[model samples]
Target: MATFRAELVIRNASVFYAHRFTRVNLAIRSGKIIGVWEPTVAGPEAEEIFDASGLYCFPGFIDPHVHFGLQLGSENCSDDCATGSTSAVFGGITSVFNFTPVLTGAEDELAALYKEVSQSTERYRTNLFMHLTVAEPKISPKKLVELALRYKFRSIKVFTTYSSSGRMTSDGYLMDLFKATRGTPLVVMVHAENDAMIDFREKKLSSDGPVKASHLPYLRPTISEVEAALRVCLMVSEMGGRLYLAHISSGKTVTELYRHFSALLGKSIFIETCPHYLYFSDAFLKGERAARFTTCPPLRPEEERQELLKHFYAGRIHTIGSDHCPFASWVKEKYEDDYLHMPNGLAGVELGFVLLYNLLKSRENEISVEELARMFSSNVSTAFGMFPQKGSLLPGADADITLFDPNAEWKVTLDTLHGRNDYDPYEGLKMKGKVDSTIIGGKFVVRNKQWVSTRVS
Candidate 1:
């Protein structure tokens, strides 16, 4: 018998696998996990060893929805590939899935958009995947399938609102998209909000007086999301298509999902909620600095927020994406009074894992570390068709992993985070769990809470 030698070994850690945590030693070679064995079972010899005692090793976190280098009109998002991905790695994210440029009614724009996105990959510190955005109904189903196969992307994003911005897709087109991608690896990702309902509400609200940030809830009410979600569910059910609903802010929508289509969940349909929705309420949009909390499908009321949390604890929600699109403070400040035109997003990629971990730790009996790994890593990878390879600790998987300190305590501050943005939405909050190190492809990108990767200069 020959001795097995590994390039790297992580020893004496509580490694999450098969929905449970167990003490194990992981051996890696050439950026792949080759062995996960009991410490008592004579582990392979390694050239280098990492003492992971007292740490919990999880599959590296994945932020399934992020907007890096996103542009809206003349202004651009503050974080680009290098800076945004650096922030992600610091947050324990080893892979990110972002969106491609909006595909309007033109076929010619596809090639150029592909080139632009492909060229931007060199700046990414984390593994990057993209979802094609279909803005208009002019794109054919054949074209979408062809693009999905050619690019190896597994999802397409479409908006049901933002009609004024020309990003809204008609119900007819959505149905066609669903029917087209049925029985395929592609999942239809929808920004579920009724455009006509929003427009009507906005018009009605404006008739009363000038709309401020506080009026955000009134402008884009929960009913809009609930209605649109039901519509999407019906369409997917009829057409037998897979779906991923993005940034669900309303608990009422979750209730409606279970009431009507509970069986579809974790099967044909998946739901995603953001940290902001779980933490902040519509009350945050009332006073000065409210613009900072402004995001699409605006934060819900306290009751709804609490309800959403209850469902998450009940295991209804599938994943948590940062929805991390941040503008400089100046950009948000400029729209302080004119929130109707304000950009809709928040920055939390760096805080998402800690936020969820802290919440779960507070109610340790309700959720386990294994479930957290599923929401932050495995479930997302499964939904997006990257499982086993990108989201598991099993042999033959990528050696991407996150080491977390379950007892570490820290407060959110500008000094504790990294990004190009000038402000953090989660600033001033205390966090219990902290990411001690992040490994991608068997290499340390973040060690001892510090980034050491030169890949994203």
Candidate 2:
């Protein structure tokens, strides 16, 4: 037999696969994993060897929700594809699913939008995919599916609020969309919030006084989210469609989901929550820099935050998305006093894994590293049709891997991060674990907590 030679070899690592960890050696050639064997087994010859002793090796993470180069009003978000991808890699994310600009309700615009988004991602260091946004119900379902197949997108996003901005879809339209896409590979993602309730509350709040950041929870209240989530559940249950709820903020939403729709939990409904919602609370919205913590479905109260964490530990949450939309500090400061005009998002793409790992270690001791892998990497890939290939260490899978040192400790600050923004929402927070390196398609994009450029053949 010809000698087995590999381009790269990783040895003596605790590799996560099949929902468990085991000591193994991996051989890679041409960006694909070709061997996963016991460490005692004779290893293949390789040009380069990576000793990962005592490190935990996981499939690279996938952030299913992100908005790179998003434009809101007159100012664009600080991180474009180049900078955002760099931040993602540094945080152990090897791939991302970014949303397209709002659709114009015309089928002809699909190609143009795809071209535009594809061009923007040309400089991304991580592999990039897209989620189509159906802002208007004008495009037919058949065309939506066709376009998705043409573009290889696995999901579509719609909103139940933001009607004033022309982003809301009516119940009739949503139902129609559900019925049309049922039994297909396409999953409909909803920003579930009752628009009518919001409009009424906002009008009342505006009439009473100028809206401040602290009044965010009242302005869009948890009841609105619960009602909308129930409505979507009913629609999906009736139509037998796939649904994904985005950035679930209130614990009440999770409670109501289990209370009413337990049957659909993983079978048809997938839930995603952001790190900000899990870590910070409305308390962050009271300080002078409250605008930095502002995001849609604004942070909830401490009681609700604690409840959310409980459900998360109980395995009610499916995945974690950063919802990473960042604005320059000055841009947030521009509307500091005006809550309505301030953009809704924060920077978490670079700190998500570290923050969550620390939170889990401190609070949920029973939660194992395997569960973290599922939340941060595998489950996300499975949901978006990128499984095994992008989220597994199996043979023939892409060699996208992350090396983590569970003992490493670091403090988060604006100066220590890599995004395009000047401020970090997690500034001053102590992190217990850190990403040691990130490899994408067998190329070292980040090594030793620093980024390095390596071209893959």
Candidate 3:
């Protein structure tokens, strides 16, 4: 009968802990998890009570990759942190691995991007952190890694295919980037594709200006990615470094990593896949949606989509990300004219978790809830060294939590979403589950199906 002193209490929520669902009540105090016990436990003294009846309470999603403060190839778009975080909040994500770049000019963009993140922090319904990619592409890669470390970024991402910002460092340089950051607690995130191969293909296709949707077969081929992975894995072993491949869309790339030659990974390489890559494919390219579906390292055939699903089932795929890029119709106009000209990403943050739940629950009925946690939260946190503090909802972790309705059915459409992008890659696809409520730092950011205007802790 004691009055519990707490900020808030979420009751009657069926919890998914580590994996299995257990009915429990959560007590949060000062933004930290205070207690998780039987729902009948005495109510703690709290400012508010959130009823999560008929819902599944799981650790809020930890999106391992995201980028903001940049536009569609230098063009303005609709959402910034305000709308971006709004989408994340609605999606039940509590933390975002904000992927940032060291701008083209003097590092002034670095300071400005940080400022945007900080200002957006208070407004962000979710916690936002960043990773910086700054190993000089041509110079001493070791020194570039040192500079990235000195800059205090959480991680590093390099593009093996894009060299516009000097992100494509040589293999020797890649090893240097890794060897230098090895024990420094910084993990390397590589886009993982061969720039030279892509360049050759692009040149061969010069006669085909702004290529067609069907041209994906020749442009940015999977072989380019597989060959790059082979090279990086070798370099990683040679340098004793850890690397994570970003948004792998094809089965051949996964097989190349696991079957043909994984000796180079040395057991340190991790795999990441995106939602769009899972559901959509070249099918759209042949239809009216071609422009809406183009992405770098383009989407593969349907068989490949099933192959990725198999990888997830077999545990060969580990980490997952959104690669959430927003390009409004205005920005997408060029690409719409020519598939090859379109920006290569989609707004996937909001729909990711629910889709995964639907996939596992339907096809692979026994996909361990623990496994889901590992891929969505724990695995990403561990890969980035952010565990025990940010990814779990245990008694002592941050009280960031999500309440999902396993039976909630909804159709995804732009009219129903918060991202700035006007088109959704998942439009009309029926989803069987959804996050009904999201709590970050003990504050009910999404309550009764709307955004609440208050901050917690």
Q: Specify the highest-lDDT model's number.
A: 1
With a 3 Å backbone cut-off (N, CA, C), the pairs that clash in candidate 1 are: none
RMSD of each candidate?
Answer: 1.5, 1.6, 2.9
Q: Cα deviation in Å at residue 79, candidate 3? A: 2.6
TM-score, every prediction: 0.97, 0.97, 0.90
**lDDT string, candidate 1, 152-262, tens digits:** 778989999988878898898889889988878899999999899999988887788767778899899999999999999999999888999999998889989999999
* Predicted candidate 2 versus true structure: per-residue lDDT over 275-320, tens digit per residue: 9988888999888888777899999999999889888777789899
Worst window of 10 by summed lDDT in candidate 3? 101-110
- Of the two candidates 1 and 3, the one with more favorable lDDT, higher being better, is 1
Q: What stretches of model 2 exceed 4 Å from their correct place?
A: 1-3, 454-457
Candidate 3: which pairs clash?
A: 4-45, 66-99, 295-344
Candidate 3 per-residue lDDT, tens place, 166-235, comes to 5565566677777887777678888888788777776677565656656765678778888887778777
CA displacement after TM-score superposition, residue 448 of candidate 3 (Å): 2.8
By lDDT, is 2 or 3 better?
2
